[model samples]
Target: MQLLQKFKLGKSKKSPSKGHANYAYTTARVRAMKSKILPKETYPRLMNMSIDEITRFIGESEYKEDIDELARIHDGVDLIEHALNRNLAVTFTKLLSISEGDVNFLVGEKLKKYDIWNIKTLLRGKYCNASTEEILEAIVAAGRLSYSFLSSLAAKGTYEEVISELANTEYYPILKGYDGTNLSDIENQLDKMYYAGLFGTIRESKSKDRKLFAEFIRMGIDLKNLVTLFRLKKSGIADPEMMNLMIDGGLRLKHRDIEKMMPLSFADFVSELESNPYWDVMADVVRPDMVSLIDIETRLKKHRLKSAASFSHVYPISIVPIMDYMLSKQNEISNLRIIVRGKAANLDDDIIKEQLVI
Candidate 1:
């Protein structure tokens, strides 16, 4: 993957915090954020907490502002979910504010997932007849799409109006022809479009520093593809039906590979994730119990976050650290939501703990 010799852009591609990039400064900030991230050791202590205790605990963490802002109107899991999403949005928005050049481009590319997320939120909200306020809370304004645009789209009365709102964007072309009633179909198109755009951006880049960034996307796509593949297989879905859900362009897992594997069984893929038979290095974090799908998904995500942090070190000056920090912060928000929701539902501590990626 070393393209330094093959492609030279005649610019200081390795610029850190000094001169061209604020890399040194950004890395320092990212390191500090990483350090302040909820310690893995603290998850056990958190699992023992009740709803009120968990809310209080969250108030004391980095999410205090988000909590205070939303606590006045929302309560319990709702309060926590909105607050967590807000804080996650703020965190990623801050990443973009502080970054520039390749770092900015790479982070922006990765954050496009939120763009897709916001679109899905719009679709689901419209389908369920949810309020604009509710959908607004779910929108993370970290991607190129402005908060104003999303807010406007969220306020639209119908999904057709929403799609019309996005007529000028990349999502327009794919979403325009879809039957608006089938949210599942639209969501699949959005996912494929998002990944296709991301892969295209990285592949088009001539910078060597961006190589690892591409690798990161490949890893993510691979994980997502596997998770979706297994879910479909376990449900006894026919091979012919998975084409839309299956994402293309993975590191080792391709569309053709998926086509060949789907008609067989899920056991082989389960074992791969369970024991890391193929990718031995990822075994430690993604050791799924095979009983619970949540466990498998959690394992995959936890490993993905862990690997992001580790890989950041390998290219500290590049986009790695900033992007890694973004994922870690996102994981923090997800963990908090899981805890809040689990506790509010009166689920046991151990059950809540099982869902924690920390």
Candidate 2:
């Protein structure tokens, strides 16, 4: 708890002049939680367990409270998934609570991205006509939006009503143009708007910590854009406007480059990548007909994690370390979830191995 207390991201309103001291307490706490993240050996054991066994095992771990709370309402993969979301929400909220200074402010600001995610989830759920409970299950509590607000949005019975509710929020204005469209168009609008907001925030941050944070997010956006571009090209979408949906900042690729590459084959795309800075890390994943979106995403995540970890070492006193820990923890959680699912599906070890991030 000492480490957790020290690593808080909040700043005291009473002491406006104190700089990094605001993060002292929160940073310490974050460090302690970082220490508690699953060890490398834990995954091997988890990989051998069924979903139920994995749930029970997590009940004995840091997720004990969430598992206990969710077990009555869910079982199997549903239970595990809900418990994971609950734990994530609780952990991120705890992080928010412990923060006090500028660090707190910045973290809170970043967490708003989760609000954007929640809105997208609500819109998608509404379009699909999912039940209220099903929609509620998708809400990740890791963002700045209140649970009450999210619950209200999730409970909305129609897409129109959901959009009306969101109209009061920041994303409403951005989504206005997409009203009365198919779900795909709405989803694309959400994606573009979210990244646009993220880049806007990055542009405004002035601190070293903020710069690192911006870069981390930008890298993720760039990877996503790259993947989307590749996918659309494979689908034979030659129109540049269609490709523009995948545009994101932080990449050296220009609009012209994306347009010119629209008609190229996947092999040509791989060749283009081979000539770029990302070549070394993405070389193995490059190929014609490479449609493994999950694998490409996993590779991108690993690259981001490695970059964040390296940056943290270089800027230990800044927010980089805390952000690094957050990203690492997320990867750990995702990896464990994959392992659990693989075991439950009874996939062969080699196949599972191919899916794993570690």
Candidate 3:
């Protein structure tokens, strides 16, 4: 597999840093917090429970406070959805609060994706004339941008007004190009900017942990690109058009390699992936004629979390554990939402089981 072969090709060039960040305190705190995450065995029990039962289950667990706080105004899946978002936001914000120096900076950098996500949500909500309440429901203030700030943006009367509000920020440069019909384009650019900025942040870091984190980031990019390729290929999108959608700087699949794979037929694409490192994790689920990419996507997500946890053990005192905890916490939230929402939608237990990472 050229993908695996290329993994041995070279490493990212790095520059030295004189700044200091002792992560022992942060890592310890994160580990303690991670222990509170719902155990894997809990999902099976949740699967058998009614929506109310599941709600009550989480209500008595880590999410109890969130449920209690929101129970007055929301119930059922709506309560779960809002509580999940709030809990996630509080969880992530707590991460920033507990860390200092480079640790805080790195955590903040990773969390910026939520900021980008909120911006995209605001733009999307405004683009579709979605009500402010509807837009705010989608916001997860997990980034440096506060929930109140995002809520205010969502309440903006126009996309242009939202853009005007963001003018002083780094995203304004790209947001200015939004001409009403280019929401997708704007969203794509914002997404690209995030990876670009994140890669740049770690590119010159002298810390071994940051370098390892870079590897983890690249692995995520590779999986994201693969999902994008799979989705576009399944949709019969032309190969040339696929390049524009592909993000740069994957760990195994470089830009050039993705370029080469772009022109291949869907079957050929699947064949090419057989040589990729991720193929082992996804091989059983991937096929040229697969009906949906959801299974493959879900498998990759599980793999990513597994990989993060595995790496954390090798560098217990470093950012790896912190990142692992972050991923685990997010996974816990996602699993809870899936169970509650799936039950509300009358989805089968087996289907919900397939979606849960644990």
lDDT of 3 by residue, 1-358 (tens): 4346337544542433223465889999999999999888888888888888888988998889999999999988999899999999999999998888678888888999999999998988888899999999899999999988898898889999999999889999999998999888888898889998888878876557779879888988998998888887787765586698888899987888788888887888899989887889998988988887889889989999999999999989888899999899988888888888888889988888888888
TM-score winner: 3
Cα-based lDDT for every prediction = 0.76, 0.72, 0.86
Off by over 4 Å in 1: 1-21, 267-290
RMSD of 3: 6.4
> Which candidate's lDDT is highest?
3
lDDT of 1 by residue, 93-118 (tens): 78878877556766777788888888
> Which scores greater on lDDT, model 2 or model 3?
3
TM-score of each model, paired residue for residue: 0.86, 0.84, 0.92
Q: Which pairs, if any, clash in model 1?
A: 17-24
Ranking by TM-score: 3, 1, 2
